[model samples]
Target: MTDLELTELVKEISLADFGKAFKHQAMFNRRLRTTGGRYMLQSHHIEINPASYKEFGTDELVGIIKHELCHYHLHIEGRGYLHRDRDFRELLEQTGSPRFCSLVQSKARTKPVKRYIYACIDCRCEYARKIRMNTARYRCGKCNGKLRLKSE
Candidate 1:
Protein backbone atom coordinates (compact mmCIF):
# COMPACT_ATOMS: atom_id res chain seq x y z
CA MET A 1 0.00 0.00 0.00
CA THR A 2 0.97 3.64 -0.43
CA ASP A 3 2.04 6.12 2.24
CA LEU A 4 -1.45 7.61 2.39
CA GLU A 5 -2.97 4.21 3.10
CA LEU A 6 -0.31 3.55 5.72
CA THR A 7 -1.09 6.85 7.49
CA GLU A 8 -4.79 6.03 7.47
CA LEU A 9 -4.16 2.56 8.85
CA VAL A 10 -1.98 3.96 11.64
CA LYS A 11 -4.66 6.45 12.54
CA GLU A 12 -7.34 3.78 12.62
CA ILE A 13 -5.27 1.44 14.76
CA SER A 14 -4.37 4.25 17.14
CA LEU A 15 -7.99 5.20 17.62
CA ALA A 16 -9.30 1.66 17.96
CA ASP A 17 -6.58 0.22 20.14
CA PHE A 18 -5.42 3.19 22.24
CA GLY A 19 -8.39 5.51 21.99
CA LYS A 20 -6.01 8.24 20.85
CA ALA A 21 -5.84 10.20 17.60
CA PHE A 22 -2.55 10.03 15.69
CA LYS A 23 -1.61 13.50 14.55
CA HIS A 24 1.81 12.63 13.14
CA GLN A 25 2.76 11.10 9.81
CA ALA A 26 3.14 7.38 9.10
CA MET A 27 4.97 6.15 6.00
CA PHE A 28 6.78 3.14 4.63
CA ASN A 29 10.52 3.59 4.73
CA ARG A 30 12.42 1.33 2.32
CA ARG A 31 15.74 2.12 4.00
CA LEU A 32 14.74 0.37 7.23
CA ARG A 33 16.72 -2.86 7.09
CA THR A 34 16.54 -4.54 10.50
CA THR A 35 13.53 -3.05 12.27
CA GLY A 36 9.82 -3.42 11.46
CA GLY A 37 9.03 0.15 12.45
CA ARG A 38 10.46 3.05 14.42
CA TYR A 39 8.87 6.02 16.19
CA MET A 40 10.74 9.27 15.78
CA LEU A 41 10.86 11.01 19.16
CA GLN A 42 11.68 14.37 17.62
CA SER A 43 8.95 14.52 14.96
CA HIS A 44 6.47 12.02 16.49
CA HIS A 45 6.35 10.38 13.07
CA ILE A 46 6.37 6.63 12.55
CA GLU A 47 8.49 5.00 9.88
CA ILE A 48 7.67 1.43 8.89
CA ASN A 49 9.77 -0.99 6.92
CA PRO A 50 7.97 -1.90 3.65
CA ALA A 51 9.46 -5.37 3.71
CA SER A 52 7.47 -6.17 6.89
CA TYR A 53 4.12 -5.57 5.20
CA LYS A 54 5.13 -7.15 1.89
CA GLU A 55 6.52 -10.30 3.46
CA PHE A 56 4.19 -10.82 6.44
CA GLY A 57 0.89 -9.23 5.18
CA THR A 58 -1.73 -7.07 6.94
CA ASP A 59 -1.63 -8.86 10.29
CA GLU A 60 2.06 -8.15 10.71
CA LEU A 61 1.55 -4.61 9.46
CA VAL A 62 -1.11 -4.00 12.07
CA GLY A 63 1.13 -5.34 14.81
CA ILE A 64 3.92 -3.01 13.75
CA ILE A 65 1.52 -0.09 13.60
CA LYS A 66 0.22 -0.89 17.06
CA HIS A 67 3.74 -1.16 18.44
CA GLU A 68 4.65 2.21 17.01
CA LEU A 69 1.44 3.78 18.20
CA CYS A 70 2.21 2.65 21.73
CA HIS A 71 5.35 4.73 21.54
CA TYR A 72 3.54 7.63 19.90
CA HIS A 73 0.71 7.92 22.42
CA LEU A 74 2.86 7.42 25.50
CA HIS A 75 5.51 9.89 24.41
CA ILE A 76 2.95 12.52 23.47
CA GLU A 77 1.36 12.33 26.89
CA GLY A 78 4.74 12.86 28.68
CA ARG A 79 4.72 9.36 30.18
CA GLY A 80 7.38 6.65 29.97
CA TYR A 81 7.60 5.76 26.26
CA LEU A 82 10.75 3.68 26.16
CA HIS A 83 10.64 -0.07 25.77
CA ARG A 84 12.05 -0.59 29.25
CA ASP A 85 9.48 1.74 30.82
CA ARG A 86 6.50 0.43 32.78
CA ASP A 87 3.96 2.57 30.97
CA PHE A 88 5.12 1.33 27.57
CA ARG A 89 4.98 -2.30 28.63
CA GLU A 90 1.51 -1.90 30.13
CA LEU A 91 0.19 -0.16 27.03
CA LEU A 92 1.57 -2.93 24.81
CA GLU A 93 -0.17 -5.60 26.91
CA GLN A 94 -3.37 -3.57 27.12
CA THR A 95 -3.54 -3.15 23.35
CA GLY A 96 -2.45 -6.76 22.65
CA SER A 97 0.40 -5.51 20.55
CA PRO A 98 3.54 -7.51 19.99
CA ARG A 99 6.77 -6.52 21.68
CA PHE A 100 8.63 -7.35 18.47
CA CYS A 101 7.56 -7.94 14.90
CA SER A 102 8.30 -10.97 12.71
CA LEU A 103 11.57 -11.15 10.87
CA VAL A 104 11.75 -10.22 7.19
CA GLN A 105 13.26 -13.04 5.12
CA SER A 106 14.62 -10.77 2.40
CA LYS A 107 16.83 -8.85 4.83
CA ALA A 108 18.35 -12.02 6.29
CA ARG A 109 21.82 -13.03 5.19
CA THR A 110 21.78 -16.04 2.81
CA LYS A 111 25.28 -15.97 1.31
CA PRO A 112 27.62 -18.85 2.01
CA VAL A 113 30.40 -17.93 4.44
CA LYS A 114 34.03 -18.56 3.53
CA ARG A 115 36.14 -20.62 5.92
CA TYR A 116 39.88 -20.28 6.52
CA ILE A 117 41.79 -23.57 6.81
CA TYR A 118 45.09 -23.86 8.64
CA ALA A 119 47.37 -26.87 9.17
CA CYS A 120 50.43 -27.63 11.26
CA ILE A 121 53.60 -28.24 9.26
CA ASP A 122 54.95 -30.92 11.62
CA CYS A 123 51.82 -32.70 12.95
CA ARG A 124 49.50 -32.06 9.97
CA CYS A 125 46.74 -31.03 12.42
CA GLU A 126 44.11 -28.88 10.68
CA TYR A 127 42.04 -26.04 12.07
CA ALA A 128 39.08 -24.34 10.39
CA ARG A 129 38.09 -20.83 11.33
CA LYS A 130 35.69 -18.15 10.15
CA ILE A 131 38.47 -15.53 10.16
CA ARG A 132 42.04 -15.80 8.88
CA MET A 133 44.78 -16.11 11.51
CA ASN A 134 48.46 -15.17 11.19
CA THR A 135 50.57 -18.34 10.74
CA ALA A 136 53.79 -16.66 11.91
CA ARG A 137 52.44 -15.55 15.26
CA TYR A 138 50.31 -18.61 16.03
CA ARG A 139 51.40 -22.25 16.53
CA CYS A 140 49.51 -25.55 16.53
CA GLY A 141 48.08 -26.63 19.91
CA LYS A 142 48.68 -30.35 19.31
CA CYS A 143 52.51 -30.34 19.17
CA ASN A 144 53.45 -26.63 19.21
CA GLY A 145 54.38 -26.97 15.55
CA LYS A 146 54.55 -24.22 12.96
CA LEU A 147 51.18 -23.44 11.34
CA ARG A 148 50.67 -22.95 7.61
CA LEU A 149 47.74 -21.82 5.51
CA LYS A 150 46.21 -25.00 4.05
CA SER A 151 43.35 -23.46 2.00
CA GLU A 152 40.91 -20.58 2.06
Candidate 2:
Protein backbone atom coordinates (compact mmCIF):
# COMPACT_ATOMS: atom_id res chain seq x y z
CA MET A 1 0.00 0.00 0.00
CA THR A 2 1.04 3.62 -0.48
CA ASP A 3 2.13 5.94 2.32
CA LEU A 4 -1.22 7.71 2.37
CA GLU A 5 -3.05 4.43 2.76
CA LEU A 6 -0.69 3.42 5.53
CA THR A 7 -1.26 6.69 7.34
CA GLU A 8 -5.04 6.27 7.13
CA LEU A 9 -4.80 2.72 8.41
CA VAL A 10 -2.66 3.85 11.33
CA LYS A 11 -5.12 6.59 12.17
CA GLU A 12 -8.04 4.16 11.99
CA ILE A 13 -6.30 1.64 14.21
CA SER A 14 -5.24 4.28 16.72
CA LEU A 15 -8.79 5.54 17.16
CA ALA A 16 -10.32 2.06 17.23
CA ASP A 17 -7.84 0.41 19.58
CA PHE A 18 -6.49 3.19 21.75
CA GLY A 19 -9.41 5.63 21.47
CA LYS A 20 -6.86 8.31 20.63
CA ALA A 21 -6.12 10.23 17.46
CA PHE A 22 -2.84 9.64 15.64
CA LYS A 23 -1.75 13.07 14.55
CA HIS A 24 1.47 11.94 12.93
CA GLN A 25 2.86 10.55 9.70
CA ALA A 26 2.85 6.90 8.78
CA MET A 27 4.85 5.73 5.78
CA PHE A 28 6.13 2.60 4.11
CA ASN A 29 9.84 2.35 4.75
CA ARG A 30 11.60 -0.09 2.43
CA ARG A 31 14.85 0.21 4.37
CA LEU A 32 13.29 -1.33 7.46
CA ARG A 33 14.53 -4.88 7.07
CA THR A 34 14.78 -5.99 10.66
CA THR A 35 11.41 -4.80 12.03
CA GLY A 36 7.83 -4.66 10.83
CA GLY A 37 7.40 -1.12 12.20
CA ARG A 38 9.06 1.54 14.31
CA TYR A 39 7.79 4.69 16.06
CA MET A 40 10.20 7.59 15.87
CA LEU A 41 10.56 9.46 19.16
CA GLN A 42 11.87 12.62 17.53
CA SER A 43 9.19 13.01 14.82
CA HIS A 44 6.44 10.80 16.25
CA HIS A 45 6.22 9.19 12.85
CA ILE A 46 5.44 5.52 12.33
CA GLU A 47 7.42 3.63 9.71
CA ILE A 48 5.94 0.34 8.51
CA ASN A 49 7.78 -2.23 6.45
CA PRO A 50 5.83 -2.76 3.22
CA ALA A 51 7.48 -6.13 2.87
CA SER A 52 5.65 -7.20 6.02
CA TYR A 53 2.28 -6.94 4.32
CA LYS A 54 3.57 -8.87 1.29
CA GLU A 55 5.02 -11.59 3.50
CA PHE A 56 2.73 -11.72 6.54
CA GLY A 57 -0.49 -10.15 5.25
CA THR A 58 -2.97 -7.74 6.88
CA ASP A 59 -3.26 -9.33 10.32
CA GLU A 60 0.46 -8.85 10.98
CA LEU A 61 0.25 -5.36 9.58
CA VAL A 62 -2.54 -4.49 12.02
CA GLY A 63 -0.53 -5.92 14.89
CA ILE A 64 2.50 -3.84 13.92
CA ILE A 65 0.32 -0.75 13.73
CA LYS A 66 -1.07 -1.45 17.18
CA HIS A 67 2.43 -1.96 18.57
CA GLU A 68 3.65 1.33 17.15
CA LEU A 69 0.47 3.04 18.36
CA CYS A 70 1.24 1.91 21.88
CA HIS A 71 4.54 3.73 21.72
CA TYR A 72 3.05 6.73 19.99
CA HIS A 73 0.23 7.33 22.47
CA LEU A 74 2.35 6.76 25.56
CA HIS A 75 5.22 8.95 24.38
CA ILE A 76 2.93 11.83 23.45
CA GLU A 77 1.26 11.85 26.87
CA GLY A 78 4.54 11.82 28.83
CA ARG A 79 4.18 8.17 29.80
CA GLY A 80 6.71 5.35 29.47
CA TYR A 81 6.81 4.19 25.85
CA LEU A 82 9.80 1.87 25.73
CA HIS A 83 9.28 -1.88 25.51
CA ARG A 84 10.58 -2.46 29.03
CA ASP A 85 8.41 0.18 30.65
CA ARG A 86 5.48 -0.91 32.79
CA ASP A 87 3.11 1.54 31.10
CA PHE A 88 4.13 0.26 27.67
CA ARG A 89 3.69 -3.36 28.72
CA GLU A 90 0.27 -2.62 30.20
CA LEU A 91 -0.80 -0.89 27.02
CA LEU A 92 0.39 -3.83 24.96
CA GLU A 93 -1.63 -6.26 27.04
CA GLN A 94 -4.70 -4.02 27.11
CA THR A 95 -4.62 -3.51 23.35
CA GLY A 96 -3.48 -7.07 22.56
CA SER A 97 -0.49 -5.68 20.73
CA PRO A 98 2.49 -7.89 20.00
CA ARG A 99 5.52 -7.47 22.21
CA PHE A 100 7.80 -7.29 19.19
CA CYS A 101 7.55 -6.95 15.46
CA SER A 102 7.66 -10.21 13.52
CA LEU A 103 10.78 -11.42 11.67
CA VAL A 104 13.06 -8.76 13.09
CA GLN A 105 16.34 -10.57 13.62
CA SER A 106 19.08 -7.98 13.27
CA LYS A 107 22.40 -9.03 11.70
CA ALA A 108 24.11 -6.37 13.86
CA ARG A 109 23.57 -8.51 16.98
CA THR A 110 26.51 -10.80 16.20
CA LYS A 111 29.96 -9.48 16.91
CA PRO A 112 32.43 -9.46 14.05
CA VAL A 113 35.22 -12.03 14.17
CA LYS A 114 38.51 -10.63 15.34
CA ARG A 115 41.13 -10.44 12.60
CA TYR A 116 44.13 -8.90 14.35
CA ILE A 117 45.82 -9.76 17.65
CA TYR A 118 48.37 -7.63 19.43
CA ALA A 119 50.61 -8.48 22.34
CA CYS A 120 52.99 -6.57 24.53
CA ILE A 121 56.59 -7.53 23.95
CA ASP A 122 57.62 -7.35 27.59
CA CYS A 123 54.43 -8.17 29.54
CA ARG A 124 53.04 -10.78 27.11
CA CYS A 125 49.58 -9.19 27.53
CA GLU A 126 47.34 -9.80 24.54
CA TYR A 127 44.60 -7.68 22.93
CA ALA A 128 42.17 -8.92 20.31
CA ARG A 129 40.76 -6.44 17.82
CA LYS A 130 38.58 -6.54 14.75
CA ILE A 131 40.73 -4.09 12.76
CA ARG A 132 44.44 -3.75 12.18
CA MET A 133 46.13 -0.84 13.96
CA ASN A 134 49.33 1.14 13.80
CA THR A 135 51.34 -0.46 16.60
CA ALA A 136 53.97 2.30 16.41
CA ARG A 137 51.64 4.92 17.90
CA TYR A 138 50.26 2.83 20.75
CA ARG A 139 51.62 0.89 23.70
CA CYS A 140 50.36 -1.58 26.28
CA GLY A 141 48.49 0.00 29.20
CA LYS A 142 49.77 -2.60 31.66
CA CYS A 143 53.39 -1.82 30.91
CA ASN A 144 55.33 0.76 28.87
CA GLY A 145 56.37 -1.94 26.42
CA LYS A 146 56.46 -2.20 22.65
CA LEU A 147 53.54 -4.04 20.97
CA ARG A 148 53.91 -6.70 18.28
CA LEU A 149 51.28 -7.95 15.87
CA LYS A 150 50.44 -11.61 16.42
CA SER A 151 48.84 -13.82 13.82
CA GLU A 152 45.55 -15.44 14.71
Best by TM-score: 1
Candidate 1 global TM-score:
0.85
Candidate 2 structure lDDT: 0.90
Q: Model 2: runs farther than 4 Å from truth?
A: 104-152
Local lDDT at 17 for model 2: 92
lDDT of 1: 0.93
User: Each prediction's Cα lDDT score?
Assistant: 0.93, 0.90
What's the true lDDT of residue 22 in model 2?
A: 96
Q: List the residue pairs that clash in candidate 1.
A: none
TM-score of each predicted structure versus truth: 0.85, 0.69
Off by over 4 Å in 1: 110-112, 120-133, 139-145
Model 2, 17-123: lDDT tens per residue?
99999999999988988788899999999998887878778999999999999999999999999988999999999999999766844422577899999999999
For each candidate in turn, give its C-alpha RMSD to the true structure in angstroms: 2.4, 3.5
Model 1 per-residue lDDT tens digits across residues 4-115? 9999999989888888899989999999998999999999999999999999999999999999999999999999999999999999999999999998988986755658
Candidate 2 residue pairs that clash: none
